[model samples]
Target: MSDQSVTDSRLDELAETFEFFDDWEDRYRYIIDLGKELTPLDDAEKVPEYKVEGCVSQVWLLVAEDAERPGALQFRGDSDAHIVKGLVAVLLTLFNGRTPQEILEFDARGALDRLDLAGHLSPSRSNGLFSMVRRIRALAAARGGQSEPTLH
Candidate 1:
């Protein structure tokens, strides 16, 4: 299977996983658990330049071209807030290790909505989530392609 299919399937799996929880509390705990699974970033990587702007919490994101893949990128990110970190994980699952054109073509907000987070997240948190998405797409654009149409 191709890497692009993996990205799309991962998001589908996440939505399925979320569906197992009947309540927001359980879903929230699951989200936090996902955050715990993120590969921790070094202190140096958390510098100002890597910090995602507009986030209520201190969030850092790094996107690098995958050494083995011609156009695909790998994402690394973290956040001070547990929920935000989980959100970063979700974004990484959706966008990481894919080409700029692939990232540009994915429906990220639709995936977020599928996870049922769109209306549940607080305004600040939701804004922070979009900020992360914007940064990821901006990185993709910088790599030499236009991003997908914005859903918001």
Candidate 2:
């Protein structure tokens, strides 16, 4: 299967999982659980350079393109807050291992709506989420091309 399909499938699965919870509280628990599942970034990777701006919590994102395949990206992210870390996991599930075109084309707002997160998140968290997406797209634009640019 293509990388885009795999990412889409994961998103779909998440949507399906959200359907199981009737209340936001249950969903929040699920989100926290997902955060626990994320691979922790190295302490060195959490420096200022990797820090995501505009976040209420201390969040960092590190993106790297696949060595063997061009345009295929991987993401490592973390947050000081549990809920924000979970949010990072959600974004990672949607964008990681996909091409730049795929990341740019995917309807992130629609996905958030499907998960019913749009109304649940605070303004700052929502902005932080978009910031994460923007950072990913910026990385994609740089690495998706023929030239391999250094990821910040």
Candidate 3:
């Protein structure tokens, strides 16, 4: 795929990084560290509109059209749970700075499977993760001039 999308390239990089870990514990620690690296969100941004619906934790994701990069999206996300915040960081790494079509076409399930996350995550965590994916896609749809997205 010579014309690779940014989302695919970033996901590949993450899978390579995840493979360096010999154990899940180490992977979890790495994820938490990634969360720590996320662009901080203000308390005021933690309002209902940004709140992810399916997560047990208080999860928020904010999406915006990036002024610095035309046709690219920017994101900020946070979660009360450490691991969930890490998941938010993962999502940001995949979707941030991508164009709307890139986000809409991203194979999230495939990416998670490649990272060995599909089976490792608890069902609740999986649902929460997918919820965040849906939120990102929905926002992307709107940004692309589609009507407000309905959860698929």
User: Among these predicted structures, which one has the highest lDDT?
Assistant: 1
Compose the digit string of candidate 1's lDDT tens values, residues 14-116: 9889988999989889888989999989999999989999899999999998887877999999999999998898889888878887887778788888887
> Ranking under lDDT, best-scoring first?
1, 3, 2
Superposition TM-score, candidate 3 onto the true structure: 0.91
| Candidate scoring better on lDDT of 2 and 3 | 3
lDDT of 1 at 6: 90
- Tell me the lDDT of candidate 1: 0.86
Each model's lDDT comes to 0.86, 0.82, 0.85
Instruction: Tell me which residue pairs clash in candidate 3.
Output: none
TM-scores for every candidate against the unseen true structure: 0.91, 0.87, 0.91
- Model 1, residue 65: distance off in Å is 1.8
lDDT of 1 at 68: 76
- Residue pair clashes in candidate 2: none
> Looking at candidate 1, what is the lDDT of residue 48?
94
Candidate 2 on 111-140: residue-level lDDT in tens?
Answer: 777787868988988888777777777777
The ten-residue window of minimal lDDT in model 3 covers 1-10
